[model samples]
Target: MDIAAIKEQLPIREVLQHYNLYPDKQNRLRCPFHDDSTPSLQVYYKTQTAYCFSSNCATHGKSMDVIDFIMYLEKCSKHEAIEKAKTLIGGDNQLQRLTRQAVLTKMFSYFKNAVYNSKPAQEYLQARCIDYRQTEVGYNAGQFHHGTRKDEALIKSCIEHGLLNDVGNKSRTGDTAYNVFGKWCIVFALKDSSNHVSGLYFRSTLNNQDQRHFYLKDRSGLYPKYPATDTKKLILTESIIDAATLLQIPAIASQYSVLALYGTNGFTQEHQAAIQSLTQLEEIIFWLNADQPGAEATSKHAIALQSLYTKARISCVKMPQGEDINSMAQAHDNMDVFIDLLEQRTADFSFSIEKENNNAGEQQEKAKLFIERGAPKQPTKTPPPITTGELDSTNPYKLRYERDTVNYYIQGGLPKTTDNMKIMLVIEDKASTQKARNRIDLYEDKQVEKLCKEAGEKLSLPAATLQADLYRLTDLLEQLIEKQLQQARPPEQALPVLTAKEREALQQFASKPKLIKRLNELLGKAGIVGEERNRIFLLIIAISHKTADTLHALIQG
Candidate 1:
């Protein structure tokens, strides 16, 4: 885990709220570390930091961020505090249950009753050729109530889950606490691999075209709820209506399992996890819309599915232009067209092979052109991606930043990202030809120090030099990180040129008695004066703001 990133993203306000402490209107709160008559701790929201001014406080005058505050409140170490912060931020992979199971069961039951009673909802389902009789579905009349006094726990759970909205309002009891889904909307239960309802998805039956679909907050579920492990074929669709249509068809429903994505870009991690559990799966057919977005999604999802299930045949059925499965089904009134489309289904492998062949032909043409230009044709040797100075060099303890390792021989040198900087630390005893290996994170000082100490006792090199070289290598890594951030910026722009008047104004400002005067003195000693010096001074100031704090400034100007 990157502790720095956690500290950066977790807010101090969240930490205080977690502890049941609220800050007053002035953003001042009583310091919990010591007894106080009034609010004394100041919360700096901009910096996500808090400090207590009360002298009697144990944490007085200490700038406590979320992580530091967690440590103090939990009475735990920094590492423990960081782990707790991760849980609080929901950063880790553990899937958090958003609502209670009982509440959802009761809510689904209510919605089911609403579905059965509403004539418009049944007609809407019939119009779409959706046979939801065998499947779990619901309808929202926008009049859901969380029950009476005996079910207070369930009511509170409903409120927390957002199934019951606008509580404690002045509206009548029947008018209050409406579900997010407005009147005449169909609700579908989405489930995890274990067949447990994890979330709710809704389709608006109203005439609001812009707001046709809605899902519960933090929706983390997939439609159809479950696919048996023995199922060998899986068909993926773009929407629940399309999937439901296919499921209503006896031929497709018996032969294959149908799953629907929320939309083009709505393939969640939960969907991937569910697919991964299908050990018997052999084919994944993307039956999305025939539009550009659907085509793009098919290619994208096919590639991802290919990576996950390499042996599974990845194919796509091309629908008629601008027509999805539901529309096609509605137009044909049968499965004949769909069956023909399935028969004409194209495999992604053919496209991939054709692409590679075209690329190869293009490369050959380029090579022919190069030869025709009289450029010397010679076989070139490529370096083995990475090299270690400590391993291959005669000076085993060489302090080369780019290719250096201290006492440890890295298998993959260093990770490019700071989050994955853990490396395998290997040391060898030349006398016995024996080796010792341990994995350690370079960012963790304690781990590096321990590795160095062990290496010193095991190898002929000194531990201090080894530790110093590792530190120096990390410094170079900071410099090397520009390559990672370079792509994040647009094409670099040329330095802005200052006008004569602007230059004169800058010079006059820098010549005044302050920190800027030091820059002016340095430029004066170099005998560089006028517009060029002003540009250099401005450039120095701009760059220094990125790396230096208020107390420190780069004095190169």
Candidate 2:
């Protein structure tokens, strides 16, 4: 049998995808034979050849055929790797199907339940303007460890079902799942072209957005799409939540089919096959995130799929810069903004890949055609915390903004549109006391005034208007933060770590009760109280080998 003939039958692009590898602008992958972050490996689309260019790599700047990649990844002899490659000739392997079924039945259930029971989870959805009832997405109560014995057991069960790694009980120790999915997250279900749920996707709600998304360990290239949709128009976005948001809009309901890629960088051969299967499709609209990566991915996807769907008109809808469909929908409270984005397109900027040079030249042409359209304009509303980089950072102070979307439900007296308001929280240590304690004094009058002043200036509001909104927002934050403070702990994570000198000072004061009492009084005078002040006092006591003056200086530092 001809090895070349067998290799020719394999779709090299798809094969690379199995290892979660994708081509960059140059149609190149990171060499699998080395620890490479950059695209050190080049895959020539025209010649159907690949090579690792990094001279230091194990591949040693040598060229390779697809079979060599199979051998490298599978850790098998050339003939064995060839035989193994033959079995992957079809789509959605057996393990992928079995694990997907198990995860769907078990993992999705936990998250779907979490939507109703968890406050942070619910707040996260509300903040995105997503009513849990409006979508099929799943939620996880971010405080998975702190919950009851039942919660711990449920998470462990995920390991049993192969939803998580086979690391046993360690998967419950907060690091295992959080390492893969991030602190707290919501899971989105992925479906096949037939629209059957076959995999789970995760998006962190606890500000770990960089960890962004995760797939079932055994993903079968099954993605999520509304199976009921075949409206001749399909909108593709970066996430399932965005897709669900589009479908929820009355103006958009049933008008177009919607689906989400895992993200801008995420694409697979199965997705390409699904796109190719749409002979009846008349339009494919790209509705990606309003960021640089999203735009580039949209351009590439549109250009690639356009060739396969020759009969369809492919266009990319513009999300306002820094605003995704979730934020855009929440801002407009309807489909007007989405329709605006779709209507803004004037031409087919798709690039045709010339047969002569299918690598750099084709990509450069694609970029050239797409970039000519110009950048997305700045959005009108206050961008989400995730977009502004506020939520993504470590908020040791637990500083964040909370909003009360006043009109979530359409009751007899309520309007259909949600009255979304943004309120800034001003609490240095509200973590230890969100409830049962008076918190109004914790917020300074000047601080509240300053926040309102900024908001008013940004929106060009009259003083009187600002005052009225300010009163509402202040009262809302007071109520919201006060309620949540009940659940807040001492915030041990927020306290600063002691330096070597500080440790020495603390060691000196450890044996002196009188010194500890005096330092506590000094800390109180400095306006530090509660858990933070106590922690500082303890730090001094633990390292009492230094004098009181030294300890005091260390504390001040």
Model 2 over residues 311-388: C-alpha lDDT tens digits? 787777764355677755554433565665566753455564343546565533323344334556456585344432
Clash number by candidate, in order: 0, 17
- The TM-score measured for candidate 1 stands at 0.44
List model 1 lDDT by residue over 105-177, tens digit each.
4466557657668898888887676755655678988665533322344445666876666544554744444
Question: How big is the positional error of residue 458 in model 1, measured in Å on the Cα after superposition?
Answer: 87
lDDT of 1 at 54: 92
The numbered model that scores best in lDDT is 1
Sequence-dependent TM-score of model 2? 0.45
Give me the candidate number with maximum TM-score: 2
Where does candidate 2 stray beyond 4 Å?
1-99, 142-157, 160-162, 165-183, 221-223, 226-229, 350-557
Q: RMSD (Cα, Å) of candidate 1?
A: 26.0
Q: Rate the local accuracy (lDDT) of all candidates.
A: 0.67, 0.57
